[model samples]
Target: MKKLLFFYFLLIGFYTYGQVGIGTAMPDPSAQLDVTVAAGDKGVLLPRVALINTTDQTTITNGNVESLLVYNTATQNNVTPGYYYWYNGSWRRLTALGDHPETITTLVNNTDGSYTYTSEDGTMTTFTVGGMMVDNGDGTYTFTNPDGTNVTIQGVSQALTILSYDNNTGMISYIDENSTLTQLDMSLAIDSWETLTDLKLNPDNIHLDYTDEDGVTNQIDLTTLVQNLETLTTIVANADGTFTYTDENGNATQIDISNLETLTSLALNADGKTLEYTDESGTVTTVDLSSVITNFETITTLVDNGDGTYTYTNESGNTTVIDVNNTETLTELVLSTDNSTLTYTDENGNDTIINLKTVVQANQKTTTLADGVNTTVSSTVSGDNTAWQVNVATAKGANNTQNSTLGVVKEADSNPTVNIANDGSLSVNLENTNDIKEVSGNYTVLPNDTILLGNASTADVSIVMPNPVGKKGKTITIKKQDTNEDYYINVYGNINGLSQLYTALPYSGWQLTSDGTQWKITNKF
Candidate 1:
């Protein structure tokens, strides 16, 4: 009975835990079945299978088993001998000790028909020929599999590696994958390059074909254009702040100035007598003004105050007033009655006398006086003068004495008479003494003629008066002595606002006077 009860308790414990243990009495609580070896040198050996590919699950008899672990022994279809487990409908390889699972991130096709693989950690590995592959050197490579089967594969040309670039020749020097050096013209491969529209041009390196004055075509750089410009000899400042440059041939061109330093300030230092100028460049230049301001005070203006005073102003803006009343001014100069001294009087009524005898000596002379017939004489004597007078005595002419006389006589008179009065006056009598000028035809009036007598019996007479420009208040009379025809008196200037005057009757006359601008008829008869 006791043995049976112990066996029943054991069976209930097994049912309650539902665990299986091998070679041990206690099983782990986390696992359904636990296998353990107590003291043996044995290990669990998993089942081994040949997997054609990771995705082919039909190779395993229990292909649907998701977590089935196995050791793959196949080397075909990229499957190697490794431990793998069934996961998500594929056989996934397990990493060995000290190994990391790397995924291929990139693949590059090489020019030599090989492929380069880049792993996720940036490790690059090249896939050249396979392990069993050999190059035949005749555009083909042979691959030998483990089954002893040989296969020939076509080989591509070796890829080229760029070693250097020659910009001047537009060529590239490179070495091929076979270690052979070669050069390629970049100009021939220009179509493979991208067009650059914003390339910076270097003036010194760029060349151009230029035709010179001698008709020679020469290769020059862009900088040559600036070097060939006309050289300037002189620069002049213009009023508009521009500069005019004159070349050697006297041709001038104006250039606008920019970014030039400007004068910031100009000041004068009175103590140092210097003019300091500062520019925008923070440079200061000093000019000595000692020569220009040599004098401390320079009188600029002087005003005479009419009241015997004057006001003067200096360069320093100071004014000074001066009185000239006390200054002596000459008023009069007199000579003494004896002619021995001269006296000068000033404005202040002061006199200064000078002795004339010391300067010059007086000269005196005397002569005897005599009287002629019928004359009485008197003589007086002075210091520097001798006076002598002779008085004639009145005498009556002889009662019967007659004096011969000369006189002028007219052509119609036999003789002319002249009389001498007792008062020493003479008188002569002539037939016709009137100043008369007779004109027969055209005659211009003379400046000194007082009367013009015209006889129009043969032809009409025309008398022209003198110009009245300078002859102001002068008079001339024109008379028609005969009445056979009318006589005309003409004046070059206006005569009483008329140019001429006419007289028809005998003894008719007109007297004209010059009123400066024109002649006026003052009298008509």
Candidate 2:
């Protein structure tokens, strides 16, 4: 009995060439392993595990496993409780109907009746309605989707069928498919025709067709029109200041231009002897003035005959005499006693006096000094000579030393002490006082102000500091005199790397010094 049982098991294992079947004798030919349920409700159970994240594979203890299927039981790191399969080094959730809800982040309506849908995963999809809804005139309306699919709406009122269109009258003829034809005035829907200012035609032979007001159609040949324009009469300007126009029939008309006879320009000819002029018509006219005088002579000498008459001889040895008794000759000149007038005596012994002040006043006169720093101008008179003397003198305090001490000298110390070192450095010991300024309102500090006393008894006071640029090592002291109100010291630039300082205590003072770029608080009292 044992040998019979063993023989039956061996035969079943070898049946159908390695295909396995459970609960059934014959399995599907395509499936390597088939499990068939004979009776009660049952299904194949898959392995379930908790997945930490989509890219994690250690939860299943199979790090390099591919195509591994499992059921995720955790909801973390974008992973939900669902069936997932290992693919490309990550677990991808299997998509099924009603498995996961797809979230839409945005939905936008486009201008052309289209809708844009954006998913949570930054995926964009556009859906366009192909065209407007069209009436089919058969009690039905049709709409086209983006994919060229049509959707029909039934039970609508029937529309008319268009038969023909008249472009000239802008009328549409239609029929109801069961009634007489009717006309629709579509003039309001038609766009108005615009008049063209410039028209270009290709091949230069295109014709224009139009309908006249009398409803008569006409055609114009553009080629012929252009040829006729070329044959029209043309006017030509002649060289002799005349214009000639010829008609198509070969008849010519001439017109003489009178204004063209006027001279335009005058110049010497290239021959350097003859003068020539050009008229408006470009005609050159020459005038011969070279022969007008054969030989020219100039006066050579003049002699006074001592009888109030003179004789002159020309280069040709021709002499001429002239009476000089009528001509006045200046002999003696003298100035008036007031030095404001001058008198002149001619050869006839007659004296004529003229005011010199009037002549001097009519002309512009300017006096300039040599050097304003070391020169002095003064008027001096000696005997009958009067002149302006400009004296040059040494500048005050100019010495040979390169470095000099410049400061106010005190009464007690008539001469300030000056110390000079071998390295060309000089120092002065002088007495000076700080320039104190008192203010009760907002004030801008000046470059010369040294100490400021601000009084803020009734109201707040702000003292604006001067700019520290180019004033290196300059120091200023500001003190608040009264403590009744707020007092602010505002720096034109940064003070100790800050904009301003505030003080309200009585007699509170701040000493600020510039380090070239900005001001720094040196002392606070």
Candidate 3:
């Protein structure tokens, strides 16, 4: 009996390790469990087990048992109790019939009521939008489209016809063969890119926020940008001065043939000077270039003639005389002793008399002439002729009057007064007045005017440079009449561009010159 049991155990070993085949005595040595299912409605059965998800697959059995095959009975994986193979680290469903198909990742989008799918299998098989793929087996791939057309990429593009995208669980839903929606976990794939998290898309705004390489969260509006780019067209400049544009929708826009002719017509006339244009009514309009040629040259220099005259030199160095004087040169003048009436003698010895009255009442010496030009006479004693020093000016010096100030002249070895003629020019005809000035007051530094700060109350004062745009090249100088060298003065407004706003200590003086914009501080003493 013991010998019989040993033989039986040897037979059992042969059955377990042998190449066995059903309904065939001569089994193929290559297949261990090869089953020749004869001509009958019969099939080989596999081990049945409860369904589980990706996380629970490994927990179904322990210790990393590979190449395990089973039939899932739960149908949760959209497979009807079909065979499932465990290869690498996941549970992959297998069909009950033909050979196992490839596992792939897919991307789908809707376009014009139809759907376009892009998928890729691990075997270097790729598909584009509405594109297919075919394996050449010779290290090449052919991608095709639905109309039996191909352009390099070709393969069998499979899809599960997803139903909806779930925002809560971040999964995509697809209808299985049983008319049931099966949820699938979705992921984003970029070529050779590391895994990225914390990226979100806002469906309402159609924009996405993602952390960039610099670790900054930046948002980009992809929807509107794409829409704008789609409508954008590329414009090409033609050799004939025309342009053409082609948009993304395969539409060509052109500056028509007639427009090209119009463009050529818009050129300068045969003289290469005048601009010619043809209106829609076909009327040719030509502008004259004669005046333009003449005006191209500008006056470069305006030299002031000592006798209230100016010589304007053009670009060609040609000078033209500008006579603003209404009277002759005053070589000599007579000042009445009473300081009320004045007289003048011209160079031609012609006496053009003007009645004027001069009074030295307060710090300001007012000199009213019959020409309605009231000259405020102020003085700032400099080096020589302190008693005869005077500065005279009017607020608005119009040429509509005669030289009423001609008789108020106080000629000296060197006249210190700035004589403003009726022609809006300064001279030294020596209109002298009292050099006294009242202090502790504000004054607007007028063109060609001088402000005196001296001898009355406090020495501190203010001087302002008004906007003298139209009166360019005008000057205003401030001087201290009082011998106090420590008086304080606030000079406001950017004068002569020296200092827009500045304060001066006692005995400070400044001269501002206007250049039609702001005043520039010409001289500061």
The candidate scoring highest on lDDT is 2
Off by over 4 Å in 2: 1-381, 384-388, 391-433, 485-492
TM-score between model 2 and native: 0.21
lDDT of 2: 0.61
The alpha-carbon RMSD values of the candidates against the true structure, listed in the order shown, are 54.4, 32.5, 34.7
Candidate 1, which segments miss by more than 4 Å at Cα?
Answer: 1-13, 97-525
TM-scores for all predictions: 0.19, 0.21, 0.19
Poorly placed runs, candidate 3 (over 4 Å): 1-27, 48-50, 58-64, 72-83, 93-525
Flag clash pairs in model 1.
Answer: none
lDDT scores of the candidates, listed in order: 0.60, 0.61, 0.51
Model 3, 1-525: lDDT tens digits are 999999999998897668776877767877876677678778877877775653345546664357777777875544446567777876677744455574455444343333233335332223232223466776556644334445452233534355675434435555734576644443332222233335788766688988765678878898877554222224444665444544333344544333211121233456644545444445565644333223222223455565644565544454555443443223444544443444544445667554431111112323333322434344546783343333444233234566333334332345455665676576654234323244467776543354455331355667666776876876666655555545556667755445544344445566767788887778877
Location of the lowest summed lDDT over 10 successive residues in candidate 3: 356-365
> So what's the TM-score on candidate 3?
0.19
Q: Which candidate number has the best TM-score?
A: 2
Per residue, candidate 2 scores C-alpha lDDT tens digits across 377-445 of: 787778945578876653334356665433332232344345445664766543233458898888998
Candidate 1 local accuracy as lDDT? 0.60
